[model samples]
Target chain A: MDELTRARQKACAGSRLSFDEALLLYRKASLLELGQWARAAKERHSGKNVYYNINRHINLSNTCTALCPLCAFSAKQGDTRGYILSPEKVAEMISRAMQETPGLTEIHIVSSLCPDTNFSYYTDILHTVRKLLPHVHIQAFTPAEIIYFTKISGLSIKEVLQHLKDAGLSSLPGGGAEILDDSVRQIICPDKASSAEWIETMKTAHSMGIPTNSSILYGHIETTEQRLAHLFKLRAIQDETGGFGAFVSFPFYPQNTKLAELYTIKPLTAWENLKFIALSRLVLDNIDHIKAFWIMLSEEIAQLSLAFGADDLDGTVGEEKIIHAAGAKSGSIMTRKKLNDMIVQAGYIPAERDSLYNIIKQAVPS
Target chain B: MDITLDTIEDKIHSGQRLSKEDGLALYSSNDLARIGQLADSVRKKISGDYVYYNVNLHVNLTNICIGQCKFCAFGCKSSSDKAYELTKQSVLSRIAKAAEDPDMKNLHIVSGLHPDWPYEYYLDIIKTIKANFPLLHLKGFTGVEIMHFVKISGKSIETVLRELIAAGLEAMPGGGAEILDDSIRQILCPNKATSTEWLEVARTAHRLGITTNASMLYGHIETKEQRINHLLTLRALQDETGGLQTFICFPFQPKNTALEDSITRTSVWDDLKTMAISRLMLDNIHNIKAYWVMLTLPVAMLALGFGANDIDGTVGGEKIMHAAGVSSQKALSKNILIDAIREAGRIPAECDCNSKIIRTF
Candidate 1:
């Protein structure tokens, strides 16, 4: 059999596909065939259950020292649009969120690397939220924040993560791992976090028993081979430690970002988005979940992604900021009812999850 | 019972008709490129590397319609400010301008159900347009319009269609088929032809030697099941009559319509997947048209690989979809459509009204 046919057979048969086999299937096999196999593979992990979470994001600040041209949310230190939220304000917001959403299960917090703020500000936000909403899962501080904390406090990556974990950091939200290649990172986010730094921080978090998700920001200047290579790299790490909880694939939105006008990059099509979802599902078999983040993809394609091997639809984020800054019109504040309806409409059970993959509730379809 | 793409491929390869379950499985599959490949394979079996376009003129005769479908933006009530009917002189003059192009092979006409016009009004318009441009093939009116003529003129559908053929109406345009299910029709379009009536008109037209094209207006409120049922209905009719010359799909333009607030435009994913599924389902139908007027230029070009073989026409000026907030050109200039077809990596075959190729680029 040809390489593509063999890839197709292995993928559809629920067998592990090598990186070369995945690339061949991804490029040469029919898109529907890949999705068919991807869906089966997703069922193997997720069954008929599609996951969502009731979460609220507490953005610490948009004032950043590393103003990555790829980010539309980041602003320079004295910019008119920049503001840093104090720990008191974060505590107030968390209380308001609990009162507003009594069922809020996760507190998803990721923010910019503020210029002059000491590493204490990062641990303080986690401490305040953890103190108030003691049981709510705290998925805070991506590797970018960890690496930044290391730079500011002169602490090791492991030491920084241990401090944050002691202050009640539950897990890490997977962000700031844009393309996971230094070549692409050099141009897109040269100052924020290097690829190696992000992975080292993640490995450190895993060693300390703090689980995290893996991700790649795709569809920018990255080639197809680069995208596949990034997935393989994640797979290799997952095989080593099995620390990654989920793999989230984000399509680069090039609306308000400088990377858009600099190269005139258009937002990737839904076809490409679905292909990436299916490809990741097939290649990253070690990772247990593939999140179809509705903020990045609209609700329509996000729901449609369930059939394309996406088993998780991220969360019903009370409001989102990062991608919306790049002109995402997917709106803020998705109700749990809306998430359940979308999941049910896609012919799956609605699984409400916490920061970890523990199911809080599974809605039985009427 | 676990039907897969492999099983469906087996059916298609051996020339066996896909069952309804098979069609549903294909629609539900997320592997679009694979489904598109199957559709393109079917398309290549019929016409290899030859994508067809026509130098035809679209003249929507009137906007005053009684079938005020919730999904439609063009059909205005008779008392509405936007309601307007065209006189014979106005329509003929419109055609006269486009008739100057020696390659203009078809004068396509479809309009809303004007309340006051007699059946002879339509007959008289067709006869006059045919007489003025003897070489232009008159492919006008839809199955809905034909049924409307029957209602107003108090004649049988056969008589109405026969009189139309006599008046130089050589073929019919496929519109007014929202979804071939009455449950949807009752909620969206209550007054138009029901599921069976649309098929009956096509059946009668095919029996009388009139060329017809089948179509569906999707992306509003129809489910995949309804979409497949609609296609299978057309496939069954085409199987019986072998009359439909082209199968067209108009992704519903919900802008400026009643469903605008509730409905959003379907993604390119659904559009191309449906196009490919239609090509795979309707095996008997020889042509599948990606009407650029509804699906803009880039999507139509992409549809060429997804089992669509015809771009409908140059569309000298179409007001129905344009009124419904379509942004495609009213009329493409000379060789623009040709260049577009060439850019899609297919030979542009200039076709006549029934999609008969006259010349190829």
Candidate 2:
């Protein structure tokens, strides 16, 4: 029998695919075959259901100290485009989105590593959203953002997570774990958190009864081995903490970023994007959900990914700025009906989920 | 930048009819994303966010066929292993099972041109189905099947269609129009009705005020120009009659057929581009369906964002595409279909066979 046949057998038998076997499958297996295996794995966890949440995304501010070359959303403190949203403003946006979409269940708050903002700014934003939208789950902060908080506040990551949890932070959004390799990060986001720092921060959050999502920004300066190492690192952490909610694979969109000038880059094809999503499903056995962020991959490719081992298409994200600054063409605001329709059309049940993967409401067919 | 967007984009924005050359230009362009965007703009302007589907069941009466189409695997000779025809009782039983669902609104019936079964045998099946399920919208028979009935019954096209209508055939389905160009048709489906005959039957049905859906079997041996010509021909017919309710584009599935070894299934890229360009070319047709059974649910859902407003319906027991090696489920539940449409971020509106909105979710 061929190596691929052996790998398929191993996968069917529920044995973990080894690193070499997974790399081989990523390199040689047909797209459809890989999709079938990934779909099987996903079905074991999620069944025929794909999950999304009705959430509002609040970017607190664009001002940042670590102006990563891969980022176009961040601005200098005096930059005209940067404005720090006050706690009242964040609360008002959350209340407005809740009024518009009554079923809104989660508030996603992510922002750049701004030096001017103190730890209270982050905590107050969560506290304000929690107070105004009492029923909504507060999913905020990345490990990179946490690490920045640690530096300025002179507190441990665990202490910071505890304070934020007390202030109504529900979970982490897993944004800045972009390709967890220090070598790649040195070129793309040198001033950001190191691989160890991000993982350690997640471990701290998980130990404090806090759940967090994980992500990988690929198709940029990262090597295949580095990509696999990133997945392995995430899997190892999940095996230890068991607190990760979902794993999202973001294709590097380098349209207006400084990274575009340093490296000649091309956006990943639909085939490559689907292949990576399938691979993420096969490799990250401990991670329950694989998310296809419709903002990064156009809605079309993201919808096609439902069959290729993706069980979550994020949410009806309202007012996203990070991806838009990096040149994503799909509009940030997607209606709840539109999100539900995309899931249903892919032959799956669209379940409205919360920050902790709880199904708030199962979709009823018309 | 590979596709110069000056003329066609301007025409689309200005609401002008696209000529055949413009259609060919849209097809040949490599900028699929831009083409999809333009088509999406048109889809939004035409259908808005409403994506239409139906609760329907497809019943193929027989697989025994006289024509020897190279791209078909569903039809068989009388002596072949898969040459069984459904009896009237079996047909009734299928319809009864379909009617058990309260929302089942349409019954779609199409079949091979049986060599031995008389025209009454076909009309009786429709009569029995309609008598049993009175409220079900009976959309039955293709233009080629109509022509075959005309030949066997010794009647004119209009009379044959009228007889079927009297027997409870409410609408016609556009099948067997593989390509409008006779050169390709001569090689692909020679024994089937010619392009002129197919259009003539459709025109007759339209004149009689019988609504019908048109289809094109694309991505085969036909050229880009031939594909455009097929759309233009349908547009011309719709302009004259305005009876075509929707135009469905079926990318040729070449599996387990005579041409399986020589041809392969078209790429998703081509399937999407063709659906978009068809929307751009067929201006008069109100709905463009990306048939989920043929294109798979994922591509079909994506097509909603790319100029396709209808994903057909909750098709039960679909055999034609399954015979051509479709891996998707033959029968999709109503909930699954609705969820698929909603997940694609479009409102899923349940419609009848005539494309009238029954309910929107």
Cα RMSD to the true fold for all candidates:
5.0, 21.5
- Across residues B218-237, which tens digit of lDDT does each residue of candidate 1 receive? 99888889999999888878
TM-score for predicted model 2 compared with the true structure: 0.56
Query: Top TM-score: which candidate number?
Result: 1
| Candidate 1 regions with alpha-carbon error over 4 angstroms | B1-11, B18-62, B69-74, B81-109, B118-139, B150-171, B178-190, B194-197, B204-210, B216-233, B248-281, B288-361
Query: What value does the lDDT take at residue B347 in candidate 1?
Result: 91
Off by over 4 Å in 2: A364-366, B1-361
Interface RMSD of each: 5.2, 12.0
